[model samples]
Target: MIDVDVLIAGGGIAGLVAAAAFVAEGRSVFLVDAGPGPERAATEDSDLRSTAILEPSIAFLTEIGLWPVFADGATDLATMRLLDAGGRENAVRTSAAFAAVDTGRPRFGVNVLNAPLRARLSAEVAQLPGVRVRFGCAVTGALARSNVNTVALDDGTRVHARLAIAADGRDSRLRKAAGIGVRRWGFGQKALVFAVSHPLPHNNISTEIHRTGGPFTLVPLPDRAGVPHSAVVWMERGPVAGRLHALDDAAFEEELNARSCGVLGPLRLAGKRAVWPIVNQLARRFDGPRLALVAEAAHVMPPIGAQGLNTSLGDLRALTALTRGAADPGAAGILSRYHRTRYAPVAARMAGVDLLNRAALAGPQPLRDLRNAGLRLLDATPLRRVAMQVGLGAPQGTVSGKP
Candidate 1:
């Protein structure tokens, strides 16, 4: 039997970060993934999505010695702009800009591409002492005992650990093996993700345009070959998104430019496009027995306000703090504390994002008008600062483990 202090199932960004974080605290860890390792995964053509690492997450990464890897490629997001273009002509009706200065910060966060960030984190975790990383290997099952969990691998290996973390994904197998249930619902909407280069500079501003189907967002990205570029997450109804994805490059660009309202002036596809179904999910509980769930395995929200991965990092932060000097990281007391600390906040955040997504899906003219009015009210009042703070996952200007 292979023995370790921690066994992490899933080698994605969250799992990698968890491994590094635990190892940094002087714990032995074994990380496993069903897919190819980061080296191969990074070279793939899929997963063109980008993540906005908010301030709190950045601090956590820096503490674990993983921030420098993403520093060079990170693009600052100094401001966030919201536009209501649900008008009949698909033209902008009302707009609001929230500057990071209002929050007493220079920038809300820095954005980085998903693949490269995963690769860099994987490399950093591998170099950390007291850690083992195995790609193309999976945790087939797990059995929890009084003091340790014995995990079964697909290769007929048995590993024992004081704690088992399921960072696998929304459909986590380890979560199921641990008998943890999840609440899930789909938006009947899909998001089209890709990178684009435009004639106008983004100026470090992240913009989200609200119309009939959903919000079309343009997040700042590092320049490519001296050209201004941004990552686009254009959300629409399933059929509409499907047709757009099936369209050829020229047709797609035409439709993209129209949806963008020419705000960036003739956007050109800078990378391959991918489509993702939208959904909001939360695990019924954060932990069971000698196991704990983190990241997508615990909670999942739409790609709005850059909450998905940032929230996952928040899980790592909370878990790290709760288990800092523990002899058994997965002790029932520790897991229970983790569950109590994380569940309510994550549930609340998921609810808020769900409400925003439903509003963005408003179809009728009157409903769209109502949504626009609400945006105007939020922008005009002091609620704007509160909104910005909530969007950053910092309630009342305080960065808590809730993140």
Candidate 2:
């Protein structure tokens, strides 16, 4: 029997970080992935997604000793600009920008490319004292019981642990084994993600353009080859996004520049394009028996507002704290606390994202006008500051500590 204090299924950033967190608390962990090595998975050619790491989230990573790696590669987000460029060309509405100064901070957050983040976290976890990682291996089956949970791997190995965490993502086998059901719905939209270089600098600002199909966001990235680059998330109706994804590089750049409304000046593709179906999902429960779900295994929000991974980190934060002092990391009490702390908030966040996405995707001109007006109003008032704080996943009442 391969025994460990905790068994984390899924070798994504979340899973690796969870293992690191547990090991930091002096617990033993076995981490497994059904895919290639972290280094292979994180290469720019493999994964094109980027995560905007908010201040608090960065602090959590720092506590786990993995921030330095990210800090070296991330681009700071000092401001956020939203433009309503949906509807007809003549009907395009207001544009607004929110600066971090309103929140008393020098910058709101930092955007880090996924590949490097994963590579760093994976490397760090691999070197931790009490963590064992098995890449390109999967948890083929799981058996949960009153006192312990055992997982069977494809290689005929079995792992016994006091707690099992299902970080395997949306199609989590561990979650199914734990009998946890999820409420999921598709938005009939897909997100096209890639990197781009603009003739003009972004000046450390992140921009989101709300158009009829969905939101087109440009998030800052560290300069490359003496030029400025940003990661792009272009959302559109399913078929439309598919068509756009099929466009030649020249055509894609032309369309991207048009959608951007010349805000960043002419833009050109800096990396390959990748598409993902947009969905909203929340597991019915965060815990089951001796198991718990974190990250996408627990909840998935639309790519809007940079909420997806941040919400996952929230789950890790709660789970790590709940299991910190527990003798049995997967004990009933600890699992229950994690569920109670995460469930309602996650559900609420999913609902909010769903509503916001609906507004962004609404077809009616009146609805689009209302949405744009509301965004303009919010931007013009002090409320935009509050919205900025909340949108960035900032803790309530957190003073930026800036005089």
Candidate 3:
């Protein structure tokens, strides 16, 4: 049997960050996942999504000494532009721009491709002193004792840890084993994630265009071969997205350019495309016995606002803070405190994003007009600043601090 301070049951972004964070705090960590190890998975051409790592999340990563690993590859997001083009003509009606400087920061966040970031984080975690990563092993089951939890792995290894974390995906087996329920609902929408190169520069601005089906967002990415590139998350109703995904390169670019409203001139596919179903999910509670759920295992939100992974980092932040210097990191009190500190805030954010998505999915002209009006209202000076701060994960009444 192997003994550790924490056992993590996923190796995605959240699980890797959890390992690094806990180990940075002088805790021993054992992380297991069912997929192939990072070295192999990183080489595979999967997980084509990108993440916008906001200021607060960057601070947390830098604190744990993991930011530098992928910093060079990150593209800074200096501004966010919201455009309403939900009219019948598919043209822009109202536009609002929010600058990072308005929030007293040089940049709002950094965007990184998910695969490379995971690869770099995995490499870093593997070398950390207090971490043991079992990439191909699955968490079969667990026995929660008063002090330590005994976890069984598919490889026939048993682990005894003070805490067991469910960083697994939304459909998490560990959470089910703990008898934790989730509230989940899906929109009849899907998002197509891909990279595109454009003739016009993104100018470090992330643009989200709201239309009939959903919002089409283009986030700045590092230049490729001296050409401006951006990551696109184009959301549409189920059948529409499927047809778009099935279109040939040339045909798809035609549709893509029309949807973009020529904002970036013309767009050419720079990479492969992948489709992801949109869903909103939250676990009934963040903890059960010695197990704590973080990231998708805890909550899953739409891609709007870049809330998915950033919020997961928030979970790690709260968990690390609550357990620091504790005699038993997984003590009932510590676990309960983590749940209390994270649940309500996460649930509230999920609800906010859900409402925004529904507004973007508005099919009626009147509803679309209402969304545009709301956008114009938020664009005002004071409200715009507040919106930017809140979007960057700053606490109420404060701006996001430097990392």
Residue pairs with backbone overlap in model 3: none
Local accuracy by lDDT, each model: 0.91, 0.86, 0.90
For model 1, how does the per-residue alpha-carbon lDDT over 59-101 read when each residue is reduced to its tens digit?
A: 8989988889767599998999999999889899999999887
Model 3 alpha-carbon miss at residue 396, Å:
5.1
lDDT of 2: 0.86
lDDT of candidate 2 over 161-238, digit per residue (tens): 999999999999999887789898986899999999988999999998887788889999988998999999999999
Give stretches of model 1 more than 4 Å off.
Answer: 395-403
Model 3: per-residue Cα lDDT over 1-403, one tens digit each: 9999999999999999999999988999999999987667657868889999998999999998988975869999999999999877989999999888876789888999888888888888999998989888888888899988899998899999999999988998889889899998977889999999999999999999999788999999999889999999999999999999999999999999999999999899997899999888999999988999999999999899999999999999999999888889999999998998899889888888898999999999899989989999988646776778876778433543332
Sequence-dependent TM-score of model 3 = 0.97
Please identify model 3 stretches exceeding 4 Å from their true place: 396-403
What TM-score against the true fold does each predicted structure earn? 0.97, 0.96, 0.97
lDDT ranking of the models = 1, 3, 2
